[model samples]
Target: MIAGRVRGVLRPLSVVSIAIVLVLLIYGLLGYSVTAVVDGVLAGSVTSPSAAEQTLRWTVPLLLMGLGIAVAFKAGYFNVGAQGQMYVGAMASLVVGLWGDGRAPVLVIPLAFVAAVLAGAVWSLAAGLLRLLLGADEVVTSLMLNFVAVLLLQWSTSGPLKSRAGTGQAATSESIDAGYRISTSTGVSVPIFVICAAAVAVTAILVNWTRTGLEISLVGRNPVMARWQGINSTGVGLVVFGFSGGCAGLAGAVEAFGPAGSLRAGFSPQVGFMAVVVALVGGLGALGVLLAALFFGALRAASLYLPVVTNLPQSGIDLLSGVIALLITATGIPLLRRRRRRRRAPTAGGTSEVADRPVARRREVVAR
Candidate 1:
């Protein structure tokens, strides 16, 4: 157990180290000094108060979304529709905010939050139900839904919620009412921090100490065994997807009400995908996700700040993130396959327990 904990800590650290080295080497070959690059990264990410604030700003959404994705992952569903779910959530919040203009913030804000969560949960459940009822692949369906969501955002910003102001370059909704906004320009606030902290605490408890959490783990580890144990895998999948999408949606609402203050077309473009990396790198634990979100958030801050402070292109920082994602995925596959194989292997007596079971009971379990 001690060794496992140590390995867990080392895995994320190694990914970070390797990514940093690769970025440095690549940029060095491009003629930038290593010291300059390092200095710029630190200055842009955490050295200054403004940079630290920016890092936290990005961390909020990433952490919330990561937590949700981690749950889906643990339940054996690869629900990658967070981008679309987030868009839908933002659109829902925007509609509510627009309709509630001039109303008391206490009233409008809660309504907006509920609207966002429900919209997101429904969007995710659409994919989950398809998988459960029609045998559709959740990964493919969820990913396709992301494009649909982007289009929806585009139409809403261009047609329904389109701002009447003069700026024509970017399609965007009118700014949310000032009273309903969550934060100022900095995008970090006491309320926002409290919300994120509460999410982390709740998710941690739900995943680590609950009966549903055990079912989710069992389902992910071995669905057939889970079924034999009388767990409802389908119901678990629905719960996982709903929770995941709701988290993503809440993040979108936070973004819309906090720093964004309006829905912009293609807002937070690749954050959804990056959040998958955050979930995996953080080992899918609440505390781990928190730390990983901050790390990625710092990288995000540095990426934008690099172009301003040094000759390094923003892509350099992006490349580092990509490398880390690649490493995590590549390393995870073998371990997963190995576990599956070990679970199926025969006992020391050279007898296969599953094989020896009655054929009727050994049949491939189908979803209810």
Candidate 2:
């Protein structure tokens, strides 16, 4: 029984254990102490109070953004422009926060989020419409939009939103009034934690308990078949894209109000991209997304403390995350998908229907 319980625990953690070992091996080969690497990850990620707070703070955005990406992927949207949508949302939130100074704190905060959601939905529609009307590649358009969004933020920070008091090398917006800030420089707070819990609960209900979730899954697994079943594929696409983008935007709003308190150039530099990895790592499930976000958040928090604890550079954690990402995508994802295909064969009406889908018929709707 003891050995059985150990096996059970090891089975679930197999991928994580292998990834960690590979990272340690690489560091050892580079002449860095594998012991230091392990020590640094533990101390910098969890042992210290400051590190814990940082991890929690970053978890907010990653969880929010990962949910959005999961929504898109579940619908086969492949909307990869979360970075761009986030920037747009941040821009809108900053505007509301800075310009609506006399408004009640509660009113302003919610309004900022509203503005962010609208901005992100609108930003994402640019690609969605193209995909719908012109059959354009969403991956390309969404990725390209990221560049546009970044430039828009750069212009906003350097021009209209530029704080005249700024005397630093970086471009940033004027600070939001203290009354409108959600959390202080400490970054983590009770209200924020409650909000995160509410978000997770709501997301879980929406994905598992609602009709829309089922429809999205149906559409994702087989869009052509979904259309035959009277589901409006176009409408589904629109809602999925908007929702995915809105979630990313909400994360941006929170970042502005809770942590940064002002728009800055290249803020949370790789978070949008990292969120994609989180979704994939989580196996595209709601609970998986949360756990993945928590893990990545810890890694991000430790990236700061790593340089101080050992000879490894701050980039060491970044490299480790990259390695983990590679291992997951390379080895596990295909296996996961193959298993899913087996389980889902009986789902597309019957094995005959899936097997009988002709080559030309399947080409009617191109997926990115």
lDDT of 1 by residue, 1-368 (tens): 79987897789788878878887898889898889878888998999659999899889889989999988877767788999999999999989999999999999998998899889999999988877666567779999999999999998999889999938888999888999999987789998998899889988998889999999888778866886799876788889999999999999999889999999899999899999889888877899999999999999988889888788888978888898999987875555444344232234443344545665464645321
Top of the candidates by TM-score: 1
Candidate 1: the clashing residue pairs are none
Q: Candidate 1 — which residues are off by over 4 angstroms?
A: 333-368
The lDDT, on a scale of 0 to 1, for candidate 2 is 0.81
TM-score of 1: 0.91
Identify the runs in model 2 with alpha carbons over 4 angstroms from their true place: 1-13, 331-368
lDDT score, residue 209, model 2?
Answer: 93
Which predicted model would earn the best lDDT?
A: 1
Query: Per-candidate TM vs. native?
Result: 0.91, 0.87
Sliding window of 10 residues with minimal summed lDDT for model 2? 342-351
Tens-digit per-residue lDDT, 8-120, candidate 2: 34543566678888888889999999988888888888997688888888888888888888877777777889999999999999999988988898888899999998999
lDDT for position 21 in model 2: 82
